[model samples]
Target: MMRPVVYGALAVVLAVGPEMAQTRPKEAASVPAKSLADYSEAMENLAEAASPAVVQILVQRVAPVGQGDSQHMGFVAEQQATGSGVIVDPDGYIVTNAHVVQNARHIDVKILRVDERGQAPHGHLLPAKLVGLDSQVDIAVLKIEGSNLPTLSFLNSDTLRQGRLVMALGSPLGLQNTLTHGVVSATLRQLKPESPMVYIQTDAPINPGNSGGPLLDIEGRIAGINTMIYSESGGNEGIGFAIPANLAKDVYLKLRKDGRVRRGAIGVIPEAITPALAAGLGLDRDSGVILSDVAPHGAADAAGLQPGDVLISIDNKPVREVRDLALTVFQRAPGDELKMVIQRGKEQMTKTVAVLERKNEPNLLEDQASYDAALVRQLGILAVTLDEKVTAILPDLRRLSGVAVAAVPAEYAGLNPGLLAGDVIYEVNTKAIASLDELRAVLNEKKSGDAIVLLVERMGQLIYVTATPE
Candidate 1:
């Protein structure tokens, strides 16, 4: 006999767990724990335990008339984007990638309704509402109305050792309740050099529709959220990434409660200490992070921290890299005291500083100067050419015939980084957009899942913004 993984409290509204009769585990399996002969069974057991919590997510937005792709891509007013999610709270709260549901005017969640014997009946769709989103972490919270919904167990990802068995569960390409098996290939895989968060790398065959689904450990506990894949063939080739459960937990809790995140900040940019700098600064090893710049009036400045100071540690955690200090500080709340040890000149000193609320900046715009315009609404933004009417409202934009965002839905505001009403988009992937037709041509050549770059001009300043088509 087999047993399913069941959960309780702040659990879920769907009542998805196996019936009470099957709640109790059967007699111990004959196979030894984690043995080669038992691994297959382990995977099966994991699937049985976690399947109830997996859900298919559908995000549909009504495209504006005549706004379809140029290649006769079959214009349809209502198009759907699909992904997956896992129930976390008994009250029907679910967790998924922000991109999976962003820009959707309508959100629907499909659950595998289960019977007493843990057998799934035909799944059903339930209307869901977006609770909160944390773009930086790529996590979102959604809610449906129900009670006693089964939820996945969250494990401490810090203890996730590489080479351990884990399962990726989700709907891939609309195939629901699918399970893929693999071992954690690496831990703490940094996606970008300067990114504050890192991912747990796996080989679990994650694909387009798998985003936001649970990556589970052998014990049927959620280890991470399978996010993306890297493949030359545009399919999973054993390289996949998942956000650690701890980070997801933090984001979901804050988003469900506050609907927004206010990350803490200390206005100081640090760089890894170099040999030359170490020699120039005096006798010392090239260790710890050294502040290269300090923002005026920011928390670091208020705490008397200045440029050229070496940050030895924060809150007792050694800071040898920029991310080391950044991840620690950014996760803290405003006014949280940070005990810092620093080396300024030859004097070693300690300082206690309060974290300041990080100020929100417009999406980092990379498109500077000017380009073209379009009526493309792929990224949930209705855009038009920066024509005479737009220039009259903002004289600074008069010279550039760029694509100006005309409108955006309030719920999906933060997803399109660095874009706003009236800002002109001048470039895409380095190609200049000089007219509406040019912008349409560039966008039409691309497909979903391809990342595009836009150089935006706002308030006489040029910045590059990166976004993907929905």
Candidate 2:
């Protein structure tokens, strides 16, 4: 009935009759067969060329004691974690995910070494210092003391298209210098509504330790920074997301220059024009974005922009959706003028709006915190004394003398008193506490199973929280 197929060194030898072979087209028979060995060699070369730029990141931070049990809460412990990063500069600038080094007291980077034979040996470990971080985009810049290091250049991610071949290089699951190949599944993928940031989606096998790695294009250029994945089982299920290279590069430069990213905003609330909204408003087509409200005395209000104005474009770019306008304004620096084309009540007019610096929120104190010596083990928080420098950032402080919570270590998240970053610790057991030493002294006096009461100011509201230190 059926003949068995035989495999050959170059191609599969299907059993075919003389008649079948005679019926084959001459043009098809004249074509040369490509060898898989060539592709394998190409991939090998690419990996060898790019592996040196991929680094393994080691972090040590304080965290909560227990894994999941509620009884083990209110205790702090130290933990070690591993992630990945890519060297972006010859003088030792590295880029990684901000979450990788969150609350990290110590950070080490392992750089792969390529021998003369083009073979990768064990990586050299070096201490790394955090340059700056932007949590919103989950990007951080680090510096290692070195020069003439191997680095990967960032690709123009806007030119990256769907189905373009790409590779993810990182320490996935603690396996250093690992490389996985895939294609760009999607571009400009927005996971949140009305969010200014977008991601490049890929089908690469990204995992836990792959965070902060580089997603490289076929040419071995950095397409994006591997940030996260969409998985239900905690392991890779093929869907992974990365921060676009353009955005990452912008943040890296800003952080390097100012030690922070200052976002600009024009005070206007934009909403996507839905079919239902258009039907109810009875003004324009059910597409593009509309200004729902303009803040009083804000840049938009001062520029004569009002509610019910449909945004046609901003800075010569079409504003088809809310994110378009949001991203454009978010990328602008304060004092930059935005040339806007708006449609208001059947009349199209141009308006120039000035961008204003958006004030930093209280939660951003974690990014500003650099005091590892301020760790309060009993309270599971890094407390900063409210000096002139700290008080300057916290201008609305009701009282200027209380210690501000700089960060809650990842391990000690569920610890006693339930403290958060930006929270000011004012009193302990009705006794006023002013500095880190005073808070530590108060917390150190308590033993295991002793009840502790903390008076904390959060977002301008004072509240009392009670807990027992383990």
Candidate 3:
């Protein structure tokens, strides 16, 4: 079983190149006689409009490595990173890739103010604080205290036409104010290992340090954020991808309000419907996502969406991949109900599923504990307060009490009588044990010869065990 906590928060920032320019005007002789003047004027206006909003980001960080007594690894001393960002709001809110400033302790945002001559001679450098970061979307927002800074507006990504002229502006390989022009090579390009959604594919040279930069349409509206280049040499090879501005806006708003994106889960495993699998299951040649497992009493299970059932749609939108279904459901608020289309055998069925607030599950860690003998006074795993998921598996557990065993060490081996990994300790010698401190106090009351009894819940069964002090 996958532990589910492996996806750590890390946003990927992407950046651009110079002959493959997107907005460069061809020689007058090469252009059609009609609309030639308008095209040149529009290209000039775009460069004038978008240059002020893009900023460069410099970050410094420090990290710790290895076991005890190991030296501290410093992001500041070991390496330095540079990337680009866009000004999202007038109040100095900047949007960039999370990887640009990962673990950054200090961030500097430089806003370039172009002079009347179209030259960026002067600028202001401001420090920014991280607002929130989402690795799933590879986006992060930072807020700085500044005034009169320019901001860019996002255009609807759906309106972006394939092969439309697009401009990419950012620092590439530490070269500041570098500009590259190219067309939207393709739309709906899929990204992997993190974001499964589509990206805006461009042939523009997206190079290092161009990450977090803006991908602009001919009208100068922001289309996507420069994100990645699919290349073997780790350099641009005419293929790059940018997270669409529409999706970036969605992630930005969610991260700003909730401090994290809460994805709705119906607690069901979805299996992809392939041709062979569909034929084996007697399904249509082309149809829906198959439910492999239904978590009992979960939103999907409660809605009568059973295992092996084909989920065709949610709220009228076609549900193809599990990611698509997940994104569709999470766009709504908790407690909102929506229609779900499912197919069982040869019959198509519909059900309404209520969206529930996503609950955050933290890795269980034990509180500090001490031993009277062996002089072992190290803080180790103790117990944890029970939750709905834990209580459902352990029956006969009272509503108000029980601490799940989280950790154990070799020094505390004698205390491992009835305590197992999932065992919940409810009480210590009839004294209530809610938190680790309470259990520690009760255990401390023991004399050298007194027997200590612990009430524990092991796999839905409650039992009591006693042990003598060392």
Candidate 4:
């Protein structure tokens, strides 16, 4: 009986071992390898189709000698910076970041040429002209001498949702034609409290040289323009930000046509109503936007808008936050009217406010002033006293008397003075300065290399700017 049992166990083991080996091999072979191969091939095809429109940007600009420290005084040097750009029009219109070409004396764009085998082997560099740049939005338009160039079309970024697949293509770390993939982390991200502009946030592994590159969707359309990265070690940490294609497209068209952007505003300070604010102020509702202040004699004031009024809607669209109101006003042109509904106490009322163009933009001020007469070489800025002519073109000022910066001369641009066009200088070293002569007199009193503090009004805000005489 023992011998028969041993023989039976041996037979069972032999049969099961061979069957297990065969079944394991068959399971390992059924991994859907063809599906993975097809997915990779699809990605490769997308990259091949989209790469021709992307370009590497090389810029040479006059920079301060001590590694961009403006305190270096008049001493300056030339520096080269690398970035990326995307062709937007077939006629050679490229979109990039303004910071990429700011103060650039020369700009070269490297365009790639695809071979018959669908691979980019080599490319040519072309000189690009700065058509226009708006630093407020960090968008610039460039023109090259080419016709029927490869281009990318802008996608409706408003349709972009979190978790959507996206791709970032640029010259990261100066490596050209680099592509990184990730998903949208967020939308409508405002980095600053006072800023009206918003950015698209992603985890697309952006690096130093990725700025101004195009962020693409699965279909190879422009979803946004890669602008910045949130990293602690100066490398990609899987967090990046981009300017939405909708805003970029608007700025591009405006800059391409007029070389500047004209933003509109209604003279009221809108603030987001939080739960704490509602409780503190005894508001009727705990959410939505509220009027914190109404500018005296401005459009909102003329429309009978008052502080403490809760904004319900603008132009039939709901105003849920300050961004809602701000964006609506920003998109409107001067003289456009917005029908607004507001809740005040127990009464809800509708009002119409006309949007006013913010004429105090740096470019507009530069255009309106006479450079020869307004040139103030001491501070390297063109100054105009707040006389009637200058006042007529400017927005409401904090003070009626001051010297306004009209432009920064190209000759002294390398000096890197902190002053910008449209800044109204109200005080020099705590002394009131109502005219350019007064400002010049104050500067003349100071010796070269002496530090001076200026109290200036810029974009309806008051701030102090410090600089040394050149």
Q: Would you estimate the TM-scores of all the predictions? A: 0.69, 0.84, 0.66, 0.75
Query: Considering summed lDDT, which 10 consecutive residues are worst modelled in model 2?
Result: 1-10
lDDT of 2 by residue, 339-416 (tens): 999999899999999998775365666677654577776777777888765665566778979898888766566563
Count the clashes in each prediction: 25, 4, 9, 0
Estimate, for each residue in 140-196, the C-alpha lDDT of model 1 and write its tens digit.
899999999989978999899999988899999989899998999997888888789
Whose lDDT is higher: candidate 1's or candidate 2's? 2
Candidate with better TM-score, 1 vs 3: 1
In terms of lDDT, which candidate is stronger, 1 or 4? 4
Which of the numbered candidates is closest to the native, going by highest TM-score?
Answer: 2
Shift in Å, residue 121, candidate 1 = 4.3
RMSD of 3: 12.3
Poorest stretch of ten by lDDT in candidate 3: 367-376
TM-score of 1: 0.69
CA lDDT scores, all candidates in order: 0.77, 0.86, 0.71, 0.86
- Which regions of candidate 1 fall more than 4 Å away from where they truly are? 1-34, 62-76, 115-121, 364-470
TM-score order of candidates, top first: 2, 4, 1, 3
- Mind giving the per-residue lDDT tens digits that candidate 3 earns over 200-278? 9999889999999999888778899998888999998999889899888888887678555555556777777888888
